[model samples]
Target: MSMINNAHPGSSLVLLNLIDRVLLRKNKLVSRTELLEVLRPELLPKLSPKKKKDDEVDEVDDSDGTAMRRFEWNLDFWLKEGLWLQDDAGMISVSSGATQRNLPERVLELIIDNAKSQTDQEILDEKNTEPFFRAMTCLLVQQSYTFMGGETVLPGKNGSAQKAVNRWLPGERSLNLSNELPTFLQYGDFLGFLEPFGSGYIVDPTRAIEPYLKVVFASESKLSLNIFIERLAEKLPLLDGGRFRRLLEPMMEELGWSPREVHQVSPSLSHALVRLESAFRLRLDQASDDNSSMQLQLPEGKHRFVSEVVYLSEVNA
Candidate 1:
């Protein structure tokens, strides 16, 4: 089953981090029973059923069966998804591909990367791409809305936005967008692609790309604006001109989304760069003689030009 179906957005990170910590502390593989024993206390409070005021009768189970069911669903999904590995003896440990360090941002990166690795065919067959598609759609919608000077609202379960996004899929597949949007938003927040705004989330991928800057730059301290964008797109294929973004472009165009002007960056990406520059993480420079400068479109219709980007290695920390 997909993460959207098996995992609750609020509880997924909590459970994942708990497992990572337990495994790290023990410095060895832990038995399934032992792992569950450790997780139950931390997980139950969040997953346990709550009494509704409208209920005519309240029958609470002493065994905490409902919580256990929710826990199992999440655990099973992680195990099958290769985030956590189980041995022949039922000994569990974090996946080797995951960063051993227990940083939240690192873990979120692992999740995002894993989701991105799934092929479209695999997603169509196994429905594992729901998380990726939902998160991408969320970011796209927010960015477009902001660019158009419209206030952002959470997509309604059966709203026109949801219907339009769902149309991105082929007739062979479909998503319950209303049902999956909350979890998608939660994941986006954790990944730093979206930030909490007035009433909902807004596109802000600066934090999201921070962890990958070194990976993208790879010892180079500076790059031409065009090269930096290329590397960033290679690292994160969901952004502007990325493989995933390209795949969605046809559908987006059908919905009246227009391409950015020549040498102009998309609003969301421009915002991210401007924020990074302001925070001293990077410096955007423009040469008087350089004709290849790119324009960063900022809020309130402001624009800044840059020909090169200097990634501050020390400041990224």
Candidate 2:
């Protein structure tokens, strides 16, 4: 089943964080029932009905059932996608690969890995693309069209973003893009890839990439702008020149998609780097010649060229 159809809005990350916390406290894999028990109190309040008046009697609440279903959907999706694992006895724990990294990093890594593993056909399949591939498609569409003065207003009930997404998909598939688009937006916001702007969101991965600075830079204190982009693309393949972008290139071209620009840095990425530099997380240095300098797109249609990037310090979360 599609995550859009079965999963609750913003529940994936919430469930993952809760699972991690419970596992940490228990110090071992938790049985399904035990995990549910721990999650019940945390989830019910949000799902339960609120009384409008103090004198009103509480009706029979099915919130427990609702909470359980949501939890199961999130758990199943994560397990099937390898973000979470289940043992022979059905004991649940976060995947070994997901440990050690911060929560956002873990989720981001899992999303990229899962999306990359899927074939183009699988990604194009409406039934198979929910949550991960669909979310990625939405983000790309947001960057390509919405951020560039397109008609898609995110977080709007008008469904402009949904229409934009449907246009990117193969014409043969007649999937009704509705709730899933909004859900993807929520996930993007929570993961720090999309920042809320006015009534919508601006394509900004600054917060998303912040936690991974150490991992991205590794032992190197400085890197050429091109090298930094390469390293970042390796970790987050949804960026410019990333594997996902390359994979979608042929299909996108077949569907009459054109490159937004010939520049090495995308507008969204340039925006993120500029923000990072302003936050004192990194330093961007310009060279005398434009040969190796990457063009960075700034606010108000301004542009800055930088040839090298030096990691200063990690921004405290």
Candidate 3:
């Protein structure tokens, strides 16, 4: 689905070439000539579609200028996607807010809000991966296998998770378990979002992470805390809010709040909820500062906490 030429330089190639060129110059604005040199393979037509002898068709023929037009169109697409920015002088560079890890290599890891709005052609163009899937992976990773001195584990087997994934996906196209699943798993593992657990894989849930957290936090749309918690509970019924505390502790720790030193589960749960409230507040503050249109506001309340016993909507209200 090349929005530009549709034939030559498919969307994937155009995107990869653009990223390669941008990253090569350290994400700086490269000149048109520089981009042309980098994207020559895709830009140049491999063969003439058809030799046109008719004078009228030849006069209006944009064959010779196809490369330039394709480049311009693709650049505009990226700009609209907020992946790139272009100056009035015609220089192009990565957008200021695209600082979620070394973008060129991990470009696909980006999680955008309202990802479902993307056309089917656009999804296929971007390697057939879903943005919501990426957000779910981030949430999975945020969960921990152990808390304090006790072992905490996700409920059900890999089969159960796979079935849930199939049911959760919005579209009609079924996931290719053989080819696509492995690729998705490998990519998440390569990005350090997953790790080997006993016989299967689990999310890493590391503390010294911010870029990944930003990606997780960027899911402020349908994948908000209330929805996420509900989904997790549905998929893994054994994982109650108390178990979720273990999953959320690292984020709490990152926000300068210490996990309760007590080994009791109730106190730890309270501490985790307190930290989660702080994290939500901080995210809201950041959103306000950026003038983001994200509707992640908490309802009017004296106390706001993330707990399974209390529904998020009720607490916010």
Candidate 4:
């Protein structure tokens, strides 16, 4: 059996860490150091002034009527902002709900066009780019039923100095990674997802979001997506980004199935679906009493992304 299914489009905050700028070498672990560099600037003391003098007796001091104070500062405020790093190694890692590779925690979200092609025109279209970028973006904070309206609380610099580090990521800042964002996709790691979604359905969000990030810190590869399930699972939750998710309906028609059919029936949805001629040489194949050879596994219809896995030839037809 092909055993393919539409993926869920859940919401995710892909926090591209400004590890190079914000975080020092010590603070990079998600469990130990999330949001520290941005939200908790206090954790890292602001760079002090360097006083200089011509001679030892003429040394000039810029201290505020006192000597500079230094102490082991509390770093909880930085933890509120989501960070991406592997276990305890202290390197910036992309936060992941599933088993995914880690990237710098500096990205917010994504925007892209989904047109598949073998030429530059394909870059203009979102079809061939979805899987390319989807596989690149990672989850900084895992979406959970337990946490709805995300909130971050952290300890203060002092025992009684509690501070709520307001880290409201800008909608644009979170989606597009500044123009000229680099291409960060590792094809080997991202190809499996596109394997199922097909290269035609892939998209390169890097170009779409290139203009939205800080140009100085943007990536060259740009964010792109592929056909991985765990990554595709983040589609629905991103509805707030606007008209991106509505584009998934075509998959239903391509599968020789209708939204009404999937919505109306519950148990027989798999067998009830008509396979595309190109997908399976035979429209329907009997696998066993438990599972069918040709069946459509629809993602939960409550989100904002296309969650159907229809045959590609069906789409061309």
Candidate 5:
């Protein structure tokens, strides 16, 4: 829509057609809005044969609010799924789901294709990651991989009461039996409850490790190390390109930090920065595995942004 309004060579439907023709084969992102934002501005403007609109001057207002011109004229298309959450404090941006952009390419594709088949176990299971991801692209199983219970085949409907519970006293028996139990009725084991989310139950379906680089480390220790290392990396001419995060990768591997730090900070950080007692350990030989066959209790999400007193202007990365 933006491209078309800008004087693009085609209609909105034409832009969509271009997606299947060129974009899909490249393993590119599928969303039209996202693609427009990502596309080279020079080429995109060619699609629209219109002159650019002159910028509107800002209006004077004590309180911050959308100006009449910007809202009424500038907004080319309405955001259908846009949401603004207003609380006692102020308004904040909210999304439909899974806004994190740094997720791996395969994971991104699977999720974008409306397949959330990757399980919690798969997140931690490095060995099966390749095969599981390969299966996601297959026609028979992409969506099915996430749901083995045949959710895609048939429309969901209420089932017989007999399937609700495995056993019945006398009157509950019925002849209309498909044999397979209802999805809703099947109660997977409700074990220990994890941490509760702040934005209420709807958005936070389930809480787990944060992300790849950070999730692998205990919240406190990871932040602390990153903080200590980040400052050192910045101040000292230790690593070139300044992306020296992977430089410490060997040390992290040798120490078997994640497993050894399980549910708690490791000895290095725990001993120096965090004074908490060491909460995990392993036999001498078992520490070789990267997964460490162990893990620690992840701390709250916000704590992941640990900063240090560095010379550079206050930075957030």
Candidate 6:
């Protein structure tokens, strides 16, 4: 198994118990409100005291009460760990494969394994590192690329990895999973897989991630854009140009980083279609030298760029 940065094994234990309680009540889906009520006594007592660190600023709403905020934070933990799924209905449920193994026994084992240092109370150190793992998974498995026994080049700064992870786990939006590149890089070195190279990191396939990818993706062929978009839309329902702007708005605000916004017009159906055509054209430019007809036609609108060539934005690409 890969080394999971689950420093809060105590919280995992609490969640396992919570899952059992919900299941015993013949409920598969538990709302945060209902779960928080039950979790107050069972799990809240185990949470470490909120450290008054000068650098750490709590973004949680003060009126939500400590217990409520903690419950939400714990839910964030489960979401990041990929143990639970929060749906559009604002309900939480066990993920499909989370219970494949004997969870009760597994939870017990985790408790036993980490029991020696459970009370050390060093903030557990990995409360937010889950994004790195999730992002790394997406980078490798979201598209198909064989590990040719060399360094794979990932673009952008270390912080960009968190953006990829946030996109990977779309529903849990309460916690900001940015500024996690350094922690991820440090952890990668400990795992003996990734190393610093230039502005990015050099990923060695044989070290760790490759073995995990080989088993997970299992496909040798690259995933086409159509399939990639479809699969991405499953997790991120708004994975289109229309809804994508709405999603990017909050992320940009939280990250304190802005991408140049060029809204030629409101992202209507016409704009979406135009964006789609541009995407395909951009892909064609990168793809193999096949002179196949793309069959792209301009939509019936004043926004049509039939006579004039429409340029694609590499920034958004």
Number of clashing residue pairs in every model? 0, 0, 0, 65, 11, 0
lDDT of 5 by residue, 162-202 (tens): 32222211122111222222111110101000111221111
lDDT score, candidate 1: 0.63
lDDT of 2 by residue, 161-257 (tens): 5555555554544334443555566667776777777767777788877777788789998888998888888877667777666666556667766
Candidate number that wins on lDDT, 2 or 4: 2
| Alpha-carbon runs more than 4 Å astray in model 3 | 1-21, 24-27, 42-79, 88-90, 96-101, 104-110, 113-131, 134-164, 167-174, 178-183, 190-192, 196-201, 205-209, 212-317
Predictions in order: lDDT:
0.63, 0.64, 0.38, 0.24, 0.23, 0.38
Model 1's number of clashes is 0
Estimate the lDDT of model 4: 0.24
Q: Give the distance in Å from residue 303's predicted Cα in candidate 1 to where it truly belongs.
A: 1.1
- Taking every candidate in turn, the Cα RMSD to the unseen true structure, in Å, is 4.4, 5.4, 16.4, 21.2, 22.6, 17.1
Which pairs in model 6 have colliding backbones?
none
Evaluated at residue 207, the lDDT of candidate 4 is 24
Q: Name the runs in model 2 displaced over 4 angstroms.
A: 6-14, 40-64, 95-101, 126-131, 134-138, 141-152, 170-175, 253-257, 315-317
The most accurate candidate by lDDT is: 2
Evaluated against the true structure, the overall lDDT of model 6 is 0.38
Candidate 3 lDDT, 1-317, residue by residue in tens: 22212332323333545554554566788665666676564544332233243211121334576655656555555555555566777676765545434553334324233244665445433432343243233234222322321222222333433442333332443333432343344444444444555644554423113233333334343343444434444322212242223434444456444443232122222233344445442222222233312222121312233212222232342
lDDT of 4 by residue, 54-105 (tens): 2111223424421112111112112223333344465444333312222211
TM-score of each: 0.80, 0.78, 0.36, 0.20, 0.15, 0.27
Give candidate 3's error at residue 124 in angstroms: 17
Sorting all predicted structures by lDDT, with the top scorer first, yields: 2, 1, 3, 6, 4, 5
lDDT of 1 by residue, 108-169 (tens): 55555775767765533455545455445435533444433444535444333344345455
lDDT of 6 by residue, 98-194 (tens): 4523453333223223323433222122233333333343333221111222333343343344454455445543123222333344444344334
lDDT (Cα) of model 3 = 0.38
